[model samples]
Each structure stands twice: as structure tokens, then as C-alpha cells.
Target chain A: MSDRLSISVRDLFIDYEIFEDRRAAIRKRLVQHEGTGRRLVRALKGVSFDVFEGEAVGIIGSNGSGKSTLMAAIAGLLPLTSGDVLVSDEPKLLGVGATLMPAANGYTNIRIGLLALGVSSNEVDMMMPQIAEFTGLGEALDRPFKTYSSGMRARLHFAIATSVHPKILLIDEALAVGDQAFKKQSRGRIDSLLGEAGTLLFVSHSLEQVSSMCSRVLWVEQGRLRADGPSDRVIAKYEAFVG
Target chain B: MVTSPEPSSGLTSVSEALSTREYLTAMWKRREFTIEVPLEQLRSTHQTTLLGNVWHLGNPLLFVAVYYLIFGVIFEVNRGVDHFLLWLTMGIFAFQLTSKTVMGGANSITSNTGMIRAIKFPRALLPISVVISQLLSFGIEMGVLGAMAILAGVGVSRRWLLLPFVLIVHTALNLGGAFIAARLNDTFKDVQQIIPFIFRLLMYLSGVMFPLERLLSSLGEKSWLVPLAELNPLARIIDLYRWVFLGASLTGGHIAVTTAIPFLVLWFGFRFFKAAEWRYGRA
Candidate 1:
């Protein structure tokens, strides 16, 4: 990795105040004299890391261990309870269930998504064919997005997010639903992204995928950094703990 | 040549808010989103229906007819108004734009949680798109109102030229309400649930079905409330439209309040929405 700091996270803390159901919340306020029915969840606590340019750092953690939270924080999508995140440029985030206009067809969604990314209408028209080819859903592109399977939705979301060739890409389990063939295609896309000296922060439970694509890995456990080192070394420890 | 630059030399804080100038520039760059998405939404609004886009015109006509039957025939609330049907149509069409815009704005952020979490654009576009889409719908309804006015013998006068100006003022009012509602609903989803009731109450208070003068006269000794009702921005907006289409009388005071309040609300609403920019989609 180069010495150029692509992303710098310093002492970041994120707390989620999840509200209870309305009926339960009302009962708690009335019977137990609770002021509010919010339960605080410390998703990230004093977590800090610096990612260098051209580095593909993979984050591994158990479910609800804040791997996704850290990805989101790095993407600037989450509000930090404390601390700061500094970046060289805006990062593009791609996660499962990230959709636009569910009622619109896949083609329409792709066009809208590109436009939302600030691509002019002319550019979107020119790029439509290539994006459509990449999706590999020729006939299905006419169907509404809400009708797409999770794998299909993931493919469309990934294609649109990576369309503009983002300098910094933060991916959270978006590839988990793709089939073997799609995974291989996306791997080639990721390699081309890296070849351009792009920085990537990938969060996934697949140690194989992480080790294959990333040179370095971070292991987050229960809202704290458990390990940060080379991919093989960190993966070994993570596997020993969770395997 | 061998000197190394500091690692954090050119990095910018990711979570900091952009300056107003920068924010507006970014929004302008993405202006197509505010237009295209809403146009797509409007196109698909009746896609599933048998009658398809025809419902756009048909629905508003039916709405005016139903209101005329109830208030004009049954309730006799059309007493003081000449051309009761046209007046009622004007009021309903104008007021519906604001109500639909505000209600749509209330859910704009909440419903688009997926888009908000996925992409980084000016979040204001969501509510702005709602207003645009509602405005397009209002345009279709206005066409229906125009045809009805002609059939009802309301001639096109020079006052008709002011329709566009009045509509712009009304849009400013709708946009301001939209921004405020979007932020409020994002923070507390209960605001969406309560908005419809509030607008229903407003419809009555704004004299959407009857003449405001009659309501004031009916109020009799409640002289204090007369000025308050007269100052209701929605009433003034409807009055402005009525003046444009029906050649109804309008006061300078009404014109001044209608023009000023919308812009003021828009300024405040923009600030209010931007204040919570980072907090949206956190839930």
C-alpha cells in the first residue's frame, strides 16, 4: 500500500438508540415510569483505523459484531457518537437491500441510479448498453426491481455503484448473494478497480473471498478491534476463534 | 525530490457539513434527479389501472363533482359564492397541491431509506422531487378546472395572466412545508401519521369548500378569529387563485402575506432540514 492516506478513522464511536414497539413503549412509560422506550446499542466503541491508497482491506467479524457498522461509518453514512473520519475523497457504498425506485423496471432503475450519481442524461444513455450487458439480465431488465431476487438486486446495485469507477469503494456483504459465475466476474471488476490504485474496504464473513482478494484484513469483534494485520495472519486468528 | 508529504495532508473530514454555497452547487449539479425521478414516478402512478393516465384528468373531475354534490346540493354551503362549482374547484385544486406535497414530503425521507443509505447526494432532493411530482399532478388537475370554468361561463380575463405568478408563490409555500415535513417525519415517523388529520382540519379552516367571508360573518362576535383566518396562508393562496381565475376581489394585505410567508417558510424549512442531514437513515 502507498503512504497516501485514503481513509483515516480516529476513535470513532456509534450508538444506535433502537426504539421498542409502540404498544410496549407506551406500557413501559406508563407502568414502569420509563421516560422513553429507546434501548441504546453501542455498535462501535472507540474503533480507529487508517487505510492507505490502493489497499484492499477486508473486515471480518461475527454477526452483529459491528463489521457493517464500521463499513457504514467509513462511508460517512452513519453519524458517529464521537471521533472523526477523514477521507481523500467521497467513498461510494454498496450494501445489500440498497435500492432505488422499487416500482421501476431494472433498466429504469439503472438509468435513475446513474443520474443520481450525477451522470448526465446523455452519458446515461451512452452507458446504458454497457451496464445492461454487465447485468446479464437482458429480458429481466424490463421487469420491476421489486420483483427481482436478492441475488439479482445485488447484481444491479453493484453494477450501478461501480459504474462510475469510484476512487474509494466500501462494500458490505453485497457479493454474498451472487452465484459462482457472478462472483468471478465481480472479482475481475474488483481487480481492475485495484489496478487503478483505488482504495477498497470490504466487509464479509467469507474468509476465502477475503483472503483471495485482500492483502490485509481487520477483525472486529463486539464493537472493538480484535485484530489488524496481514490477511493470512488475521484470517488465521479469526478462523481459530469462530470456526 | 526525496521529501515525503504528510499522510493526512489533503484529507477532508467525511462527516462535516458542506457550506451553503457548496451544498447548493452540488444540488444544482444533480438537478436532473429532482426532475426525472418524479416524472418517472408520475408516469407509473396509474400504470396498473385499466384507464391508465386518463385517470389523471378523470380523478380530479370526479373529486370536484363529489364535493359539489355534498356541499352545493346537500349542505347548501354555496350560498354567497357566484359560480359555486368553479370557485369550489379552484380552492380544492389549489389546496390539494399543498396537502399532497406536504404529505408526500413527510414520507419522502422515510420511504427512501434505501436510497439515502446507498447513495450520497443532497438529501433535499427527495422532498423537492415530491413537490415537483405533486406540482405536475396539480397541473393536470388545473387543466380540468380550466375546462370546467369555461363551460361554467367564466371568461378568460387579463387576470388569468397572474395564474403562473400565483402558482409560483403556492409552490414556494408547498416546498417550505415539504422540507419541514421531511425532516420532522424522518426524526419522528409519528408525524406522517398525524399529517393527514392536520391537513383535514386545515381544509375546513382555509375555506376550501365555502367562502371565507361567509365563515367570518357566521363567526359573528368572534372578531379576533376573523383576522387569524384571513391570515391563513392557504386561504390567501386560494384567494389569489380565485382572483386570477374567477375575477374575485383580492386585498393588498392578502397579496403581501401570500408572497412573504412562503419564502420565509422556505428559508426556515431549508435550514431545519439541512440541520438534520447527517442524522437521516440512521434509524
Candidate 2:
């Protein structure tokens, strides 16, 4: 694939407030006091990165290190306190326990998922069988989603998320849930997705997997980018630091 | 890969949110999601009940029946309004639609945090879908009200054609209200609890169960309450419905104000809600 920038996140900042008590928050506001009952956690602090087309990049970070928040901000799921995210197209976020209708069967959830991704109704019809096949749920595809095991649910989510072939895809530790066979199938699907010049930002805890699959690795430390380089070089540093 | 052009220099102007036109176009494209998700939600909402979908119609009917018992049967507070049943129906149904839409819209964002973070779609669709869901329920309730009106000596007339126009204006107002409510509720959790009480007070002021004209005549035309009661879009829309459905007297000034207020509120509400589109998910 040619080297064209597909995703650029510049000086991004995201913070979330924890409201410990509902009444306290209300009282604090009414009393005209600032920071009396709320705590602001800065999840991402002026982080910046760039991804080119067809690049498979893994984001590695310690817990509370803002890996997921960075992915979410790129997808426009989180509000930015400052900075900018320039993208060629909307980024699809693939995460575990996505809110597909639980009462609806797997097949219906597939249809809903496709439509939510802005797939046309006719396209949804054309894509349903393909997704259902990939999910490999067979007869269980007709059963309610709540009836599925966690592994099955993850498989279905991965299948539906990949069905649209988004130009930019963000996977947030979703692959960590499924079994070995499903994981193998998902890796194959992601490979094909990247083969089409799509950009991928994968957040995972597995260093070995990141070292193997990713061409580049970004190590995020306390809401900032500590290192960005070749996978082997950065993962080694990350491992040494953690160990 | 060879070194690429500096991304920061080339993409520095990229704002955090989509442009207004771009956002609306994208939302229009994914309009199907707005309908499909909410319809499925509405359908599954009552599956556990023995009565199921019947509760949609039954709940509104039960509510109207309680009001009727108090004002119609017990106190006989008809207040010379012809076809009191139909008047009450129009007022209650119209008022209820807006109230429910506003409250439902308020909860839309908070209830769907998982969906918001999982998929990429215009967050506005959530509030829009809530309005649609409530409108669907209102449509069915209107059908039952129509049947009841027919049996109560109210005849269909050419004025009935204006009902569509009334509904269009009412929906615009509801859409705008939903947008504002959705954003406020996301910022302040206390707003959700306070909304129902606010709507209850609106129900009394909007003349949902009683006639505003009676109150006006007693309070005097020059009283400050006259304009307050007359200018409220809910009251005006309910009055427009009464004018068409029950042949009640409605002034041209009232019609003009009712129609104009909805569009104005719609424009303001859409802009107000759009300004905060980026903030819906972070909290």
C-alpha cells in the first residue's frame, strides 16, 4: 500500500469527571463552588500520532494509560478538550460487549449493526448472510444474543464490525475475549482489511501478539506517547520498563 | 513506508467536530438506523407483559380515563366546552406527546452509553429516534381518540384536513425540545429528575384538562397570564387541534403565533443541540 496519511491525531486531550455523589454534585453547583464535589481525570494529555494507509499499529500502555481513550477519541466517541483529529472517513470502533440488541437474535443484530454503520438497507440484506457465515453461529444465530456465551458474543461483534470494511478501524481489546479458533479467524479478517489499504489502531495487552502482528508499536505512558517506533524495538523497551 | 508529508502542517485546521452541514448530511444518510433501532426498542419494551403491544394504547386510555373521572364525572367541570371528551382527548394527547418526547429524549443519551461508544453515528439520532418512538405511540392514541370522537357526536369536516399541519408544527416543536432536553440531561443528571415536575406544571398551564379561555375570562385579557397561556406552543397547538376537531373558536393571531413559535424554537433548538454534539459521549 502507498504511504498516505489516513488518520492524524494532533495534541489530543480528553478528561472525564467523576461525580462521587449525585446530591453532592447538585449541591456544589447550587452553591457556586468549583471542584467541590467532582474529580477530573485527564485520560489523554496532549498526545499525538499519525497512521498511514495499510498500517497495522498496536497501542501498548499500562493500565489507565489512555490507550482505549485515544482509540475512542480518534473514532469521535470521546469529546476532545483541545487538539484535532483529521480523518479521511469515519473510524469504526470494534469493542467487546458492543450494545447490539440482546433480546434480538444474532441475525437481527447483524442487520442492526450494519445499518448503524450507515450501510444501506439493501446492502444490509446482501451483507447479512456473509456476516452470519463468518460468525459461524449456525442455528445459534437465530437465538437471542443474550443467550450466547461471552466468546460467541465477541465473535459476533467482531464479525459485524468487520463486515463494513471501514477505511479506518479501531479495535479495543476485543480480540482478547474469543477462543483460539475465533481468534485465528479474526486475525485473518483483520489482515484482509489491512490488505485493502485500511488503517488499523489496535489496543491490546499482549506484547507477543503486538510484536508479531503490528508493523509499528506506540507505547503510551500516563496519557502521553513515551515511544513510537518499529514493533520489535518499542515492545522491547516497553517490556523492559514493565519487567 | 517512505517518509510522508508532515501531518500536523497539512491537517492543522481539522476541528474536533464535524461541520454542521457535513454532520447533517451524515445523519441523513444513516436515517434508517434512527428508525430501525427505536422501532425495535419500542417493540421489545413490552414483550414481557402479558398484554404486550396493547399496553401502548391502553396506557394512554387509562390516563385519559382517570382525568375524565375527576373532571367529567365527579366535579362535572366541563365549563361549557362542547364535546368535552374530544377536547380533553386532544389536549391530553397533544400535551402528552411533547412531555414524553422531551423526557424520553433526555434519557436517550444516558441510556445508550454503550451503543454510543461502540458505534460511530451522529449522536443526534438518539434524541431524534426518541421523538419518533413517542410520535408512533401518539399516532396510535390519536386513532383511538378519533374513534371516540366519532361516537361522541363530533363529525369529520374539511377543517380536519388542517390536522396534518397542526401535527407538523407540533412535531417541530417536540424535535427542538428533545434536542435541548437531551443535551441538558447529559450535562446535569438532576435535570432528568426535574423535567417531569416541570412538565406537570406545564400540563396545568397548557390547559391539558381545562379550558384556557375560561381561565383567561376570569383572569382578564390584560392580565399577564393571558399572553403566558396564549403564547405557549403547547397551548396553541392544543387549541388548534380543538379548533379543527371540536369546532372551537380560535383567533387568527393565535394560529399565527403557534405556527411561528415552533419554527423559531426548532431553529434555536437545533443550533443549541448541534453546538454540543461533541460533548454527548465524554461524560
Candidate 3:
């Protein structure tokens, strides 16, 4: 209900009810004993956070600590099972970074990726040059995406995903996949975007990245918010916890 | 374990919340969606090759010959069954949608884990794109089957108009299977292994290469499979194809189930896919 905030969550939760086997599920009504008393796995539990316009936040957590889930929920990919996730702008969570239809080439993937992202054709065409440049994948851009190296795929994905310029940019471990050179360039590019007042939520294991890029830090664990404050305070706690 | 109380104001109820139709209408005007034209680019990128676009035709034709040679000529089932290619082709073509929908569609979510994790477009579009792309492949195969049907003295009839309608049902069935597969594939990689085998069993049961008459005569039509054989969901689709193109009846029993069951299956498939629509994006 807070329209001023870019993203506001009040006790957001995501719990999945894993059903029985398909055959058992089909025969469930007819059969008396189909097995019961199993508890659901809660992936995200009563978690809450807020991101306003011009806020660049970094989320850190141990593996399986729900960093990705929190990002996905904010991006609207995952619906909250309980509570609320209110967003004032569109959110883009970088997935597969850059996806290529193995059968298709890089240029092809760019269009489809944009479309898959639900971009307008005119907008995709407009951003094509900028996307191609950011990838730095020159001559290889004409080749099939499958033929490109992982670095190239990541580069291509990062470029196309960032092409339209997202409002709520939620990047999950993007820098972790790229090479040092690409990572260096990625940081600069991201910082420039942040300067332009874009709200970002970056989830990464890299402490240096958390401290350098984000204004605030959010430490997540077991699908709950563990700590939220200044970058130094949270990263120190997270690093300590990991150690 | 802490339980979430039910949402206030009965938001879970279908009528209380924004209906899908209403939301879609609102979206068209406001949302500036980017359509991923992966297909056009994917096809164009590979256009320079020798087989060029012919490879699309060549692959399915090769499959048709392989199936016909193995199941038809070598096995002598061609002589045994009437309209051998027609029947065999029907099964392959009909099941192509199912196989692709089940096999390809199931992995749609798991395969696009990166996309699922990143963006907030319709998750349904991922499976839909798969089915549509596969449908393009099926179109090529169907053309081959249609040509063969023409050569066998079966010309196009008015019934062919229903092809689009049947195709819609076929799409619905694939979409439903895709929804289930997209979610199920997340935990079980084994689903991928068993899909081809399921298609093979269904092919034989649905009277694809072998005729339903043979199954009926040998197994006795009234046996447990009577419903399956008589109603034969797949066989009906093929019959509809043959009846429209080849201008032949695939038996009255075949037509009965084809006309009735597809609609039922389609309805449920629609409901099933929609119910799990949001879950797909998350998975």
C-alpha cells in the first residue's frame, strides 16, 4: 500500500506443497490410503525488506540461504505464499544471464531473449547496437550462441538483459560467472546505472563486491532476513558466519 | 511448523480476485512487452547452410522412412495393415505434438532456470514457445504425411478445415503436459529418460504404426483396452487428419472418441496449465 517505495515487502513467504506421485495423485480420491502427514518445505518464510528509488543494495548469504529466492520473489517470478510483495516498478532478475537457443545463433538469441523478456520489437532494434557493443563478442556475435564460450554467453546475456535498462535490477551471482576483465567492466557499467538512480539488488558471495557497490547490505539465511544495515556491518557478520 | 492463515478478503477465490481475462485486457494497453523473436533469428542464422532449410524436411522425412522401413517393410506390417504409411504417419505426426509437448515442454522450466530466476514475463510463454517451435517441425512432417496421403488417392476434403481446431486441442494438451513437466522436471531428472519410452508405448497402444483393428481383433475390442483402443485419443487425431486429407473413415469407433475426448482433455489441460501458471515462473 506504500506507493512511494519502489519495492516493499511485509512478511512475504513462499511454501511449496509437494504432491504425491502422479499415479497416486490420480488415484487419491478413489483410494483410502494415499499417504499423508507430510510437512511442506518452506523456501521463503515471513521475510520482509524494502527498496526505494535510487537504492543500490547488496544481499549476501551462505549457500541455500534463499538469496536467489528473495531476488526472484521481488522480480515477480515467484509469488508470495503469504504476506505481500509490493513493487512500484518492473523488476528484472538476470537468469541464465544470457540464454541462447543452441540451434540459434547470438543475434537470434538477442531478439528472442528480448522478446522472452517481453520487450517491444522496436525497442529491441533500438538497443541492438548497444547490446552488441556491451557483449564485446564482436565477430562471434554472428555465430551460434552454443558455439560461444561460457564467458561469451554470460557477456551476451548480461548485455541483452541490461539493454532495456531495468527499473528494479536484481542480479544474482552474475559477476561470479564472468572473467576478471568482464567483471571489472561489469562493475563500472553497473555503477553508472546506479548513478542514474536505478534501484538494484545484487546477490553475491563476494564480500568485496558487497562493500564496493552497495549502499546497504542485507544478509539472508534459511529464507529469512538475518541482518540488514550498512555494508560493513552485514558483510562482516556474514563473513564471520561463513568462517 | 508455523501455518499461514488464509488471506484476508478471500483473495484466493476465483471471482474475488482479478480474473485472467480482465488482467490480460489491462496488460495489452499498459505493458510494453518485448516479444522474443528467437525463432526468426534462429532460423535466419542457420539459413546459409547447404541443406539450407531443407534439413527441416529432411530430418522428419528420414524419421518417416526409418519408421516405415523398420516397422512397415522389414516387419511386413505394411502388407498386414491397410493404409500403412497413413496409419503409421498419423501416429508419428499426432504423437509428435504430445511427445514434443511432454518431452520438450516438461523441460521448458528446468532448462530455462536462468530465465525463470531472472525475469518476470509470463512463465507460460516459455512452454508456449517450445510447443510453437515444435509445431513448426510438426508442420513439416505433416506436409510429408499429407503428400503421401495424396499419392495414396486421398485428396483434401472439407474436413481438413478442422485441422486448425484439432491443432488448438493439440496445443492445449501439450501446454497442460508442459506445465506438469516444467514443475516435475525440477526435482526428477529421470522424467527426461522415460519420456521416449512412454511415447513408444503410447505409439503402439494408440495404433500409430499398427492399426487399431489389429489390436481390437487380437486383444478383443471389449477387453480392458477396449476403451483405450476404441476411444484411442491419438488414433482419432490421425483419423481426423486422414479423413480430411485422405478422405477415409478411420472407423466410427475411432471418430467417436476423437470428437468427444479431445475437448474434455483440452478443457482439463487448459485448467491444469493455468492453475500452475505462476508456479512455473518460480520453479
Candidate 4:
């Protein structure tokens, strides 16, 4: 990894307000004349880190431990309750559920996805063959997206998301789907991306996958960072704590 | 072999909003999304129906015919306008565009939570695309209206040339309403449930089935209601359409008001929507 900083997180905090049902909320306001039926969830609390250029950092945590939240914040998808996340370039987030249009066919979705990422229409046309080949969903590309199997959908989403080679890519459990062959293929793609000096922040539950793909790892517990160090060291610590 | 740009040396706060100039430039670059997605939606909208695309023409025709039957035959509410059916057709067609756009915009953000969370784009495009699709539907309806006017022996005139200008102003008004509704619905979720009733009430007040002049004259004692009905933007838009199609009377004051209000609403609505830009997909 280079000395140049690619991402800097300065005590980032994110709070999600979970509001009660509208009808219940209205009833409560009328009856209680006080409670708004809103609860604040502190998804991230004063977490700070700095990622250097060309670094592949994996974030690991138990369920609801803010791993996904941190990834989303770094991707600039979440609003900050306090503090800041600074990035050198716009980051693209690829999650298992990142969908474009469910009714549109896979080809149409691929075109719109690239267009949404600010790719020129002509470039989108040129990239069609490459994206189509990567999806490996030939002929099935004409079928509506809602009809795709979960693994098939993940393949298409990953192919479209990585089509433009974003300088900073944030992934959240997006590689867990698909078969062994597709998994190997996707791992190859990720390697090629990192080979180009791209920065990645991958959030996954698989310690083995994280240790294999990332040289550095961040362990988050609850809403705070528990550890940040070399992949093997952090993984060992996280494994012991979990056990 | 497109080489990716080197990572910038300097880091900027990710939560901060883009400058207006930067935002506009980014939006312009994605203009194809505003056009193509709506066209695709319009294409797929009728895919499940047996009649397919014919519903685009048939839907509006059936709508106007039903209203003509109720207001024209049963109630005799045409108010003695020349070519009463054509006048009612113009009013209903124009007003439906606004109502449909507003209704569509209400759910534009809420319904597309998946795309919003996955993609980072100007949320304004959601409401804007709804307006474009509604505008396309309006165009098809206007084509049918034109054929009806020709068959009914309404002579074409210079005033007909003003139809596009009037339609543009109407679109601006629809877009403004859409932006405001989109943001509100994103926050409350109840806005979508309430919008249809609101539009139904607006339909009667906007003179969709009857003439505004008739309402003004009938409300002689309640003279206060005159300017209110006359100033209703939807009423004015419908009146403008009537004036274009049937050579109906349109005053200079009405023209100025119709042209000015939409732009004002558009400016305010854009600001209102942009204020909550970062908060859209939190749910």
C-alpha cells in the first residue's frame, strides 16, 4: 500500500431513527400528547480509521456490530449523525441487494446501471459485451431481473458494479452468493481490480475469505472499532473473542 | 483498456453536499437516465394487459367519455360552451397529467428504496422522470383530442400554435408539485395515501368537467371565490388548453398568472427537495 491516504474516517457516528408505525405514532401523539414514538439507534459511535491508497481492508464483526454501517458510511451512502468520513474519490458500494430495475431485463438493467454511474451511452454500448460476458447469463439477460435466481442476480450486480473500475470500491457480503466456479471467477476479478492499485473496503462474515483477500483487517464490536491491524493478527484476535 | 484515474491526493468530506454547479453538471451528464428510464417504464406499464400499448390511447378516451356521460348527459354541466365535448376533453386531459404526475411522484422515492440505497444520483430525477412519462401520456391523449377536434369541425387557427408553450408551463407546474410531493412522501409515507383524495378534490375545484366562468358567475354572492377559482393554476392550465383548442376567451392577466406561478413553484420545489437529499434512503 502507498503512503497516500485514500480514506480518512474521523470519529464517524451514525444514528438511525426508527419511527413507530404511522397509525400508532398518530395515536400515541393524540393520547400521550408527548411521545413521538421514535427511537434512535446508534449504528456507529465515534469510529475512526485511515485507509491508504491501494489497500484492501476487510471489516469483520458479528451481526448488528456496525460492520455494514461503517462500509455504507465509507461509501457515502449513510448520513452522519456526527463526525466525518473523507474519501479521495467517489466510492461505489456493491451489496447483494443492490438492484437497478426489477421489471427490466438484465441487459436493460446493465445499460441503466452504467448510465447511472455516469458512464456515457456510447461507452455503455462498448462495454456491453464485456459486462455480458462477465455476467455469464447469456440469453438469460433478456429475461426480467425479478425472475433471476439469487446467485444469478448477485453475478449481474457484481458485473455491472465493477464494470467501470471505481477507484474506491466498498463491498458488503456481495460475494457470498453463486457457486464455487463463479466464486473463483469473482475472486479473480477482485484480484485484477486490486492489481490496478484500486482501494477496497470489504465487509464480510467469512474470516477465511477476508484473511485470503485482504492484507489488513478491521474488527468492529457493537458500535465501535475493536481492532485494526494486520489481517492474520486481527483475525486471530477476532476468532478468540468470538469463541 | 481504460486506465482508472489515480486516487486524488486530497480527501474531501463525503457527507458534504455537492455545490450547485457541480450537482447540475453531474445531473446533465446523466440526462439519458431521465429520458430512457421513463420511456422504458412507459413501455412496460402496459405489458401485462391483453390490449398492450393500445391502452395508452384507449384509457384516456374512456376516461373522457365517462366524464362526458356523467357531467354532459346527466348533469348538463357543459355550461353551453361551443363544442362542449372537446372543451371537457381538453380540461380532463390536461388536469389528469398533473394529478397523475403528483401521484406518481409521491411514491417515486419510497417505491425505489433499493435503487436509491444502491446508487448515488440526484434524487430529483425520480420526480422528473415521472413528469416526463406523464407528459408522454399527455401527448398521446392530445393526439386523440386533435383527431376529435378535426372530426367535430373545429377549425384550426393560429392560437393552436400556442399549445406547446402552454404545455411547457403546465409541465413546469407538474414538476414543481412532483418535487414537493416526493420529498414529503419520503418522510411521512402517508403523503402517498392522502394524495389521491387531494387530487380528487382538486379535480372539481380546477374546473375539469365544467367551465370556470360558470362557477364564477354562479358564485355571485360569494364573490371572494371568483379570484380563487380563476387563479387556480390547474384551472388556468385547463382554460389555456380550451382557449387553444376551441378559440375560447383568455385574458392577459390569466396568461401572465399561468406563466409566472409554475416557475415560482419550480424554484421553491427544487430547493425543498434538495434540502433532504442525504436523508432519502435512511429507511
The top-ranked prediction according to TM-score is 4
True contacts kept of each: 0.72, 0.53, 0.30, 0.70
Better of 1 and 3 by TM-score: 1
lDDT value, residue B223 of candidate 4: 89
Clashing pairs in 4: none
lDDT against the true structure, per candidate, is 0.87, 0.83, 0.69, 0.86
Higher DockQ: candidate 1 or 2? 1
Badly placed stretches (over 4 Å) of model 1 are A21-37, B1-8, B221-224, B251-253
Per-model DockQ: 0.55, 0.52, 0.26, 0.52
Q: What's the true lDDT of residue A66 in model 1?
A: 95
Candidate 4 C-alpha lDDT tens digits along B1-283: 1122333547888898987788878888988888888998988999999999999878878998899999999999866678889988898889889999998988889878888888888888889889989988888888888888889999777888999899889988999999999999988887888999988988877888886666667789468877777677888888788898988876333768767999999889989998898989676
Task: Give candidate 4's error at residue B117 in angstroms.
Answer: 0.5
DockQ, prediction 2: 0.52
**Candidate 1, A1-243: lDDT as tens digits:** 677788888888999988768768778889999777778999998888888888999999999999888888888888888988888888999899888999999998998888878898899899999999998878999999999999999889889988999989998999999998789988889888888888999998888999999999999999999999999999999889986
Candidate 2, A87-193: lDDT as tens digits: 77678888877766788888888887787778888898887888888998899998888899878888888888888788788888888878888888988988888
Off by over 4 Å in 3: A1-3, A12-46, A61-65, A79-81, A95-103, A144-154, A176-197, A204-212, A221-227, A231-243, B1-19, B22-55, B66-91, B149-189, B254-257, B278-283
Docking level for model 1: medium
Q: Which stretches of candidate 4 lie above 4 Å from their native place?
A: A23-35, B1-9, B221-224, B251-253
Range of the 10 consecutive residues with the lowest summed lDDT in candidate 3 chain A: A1-10
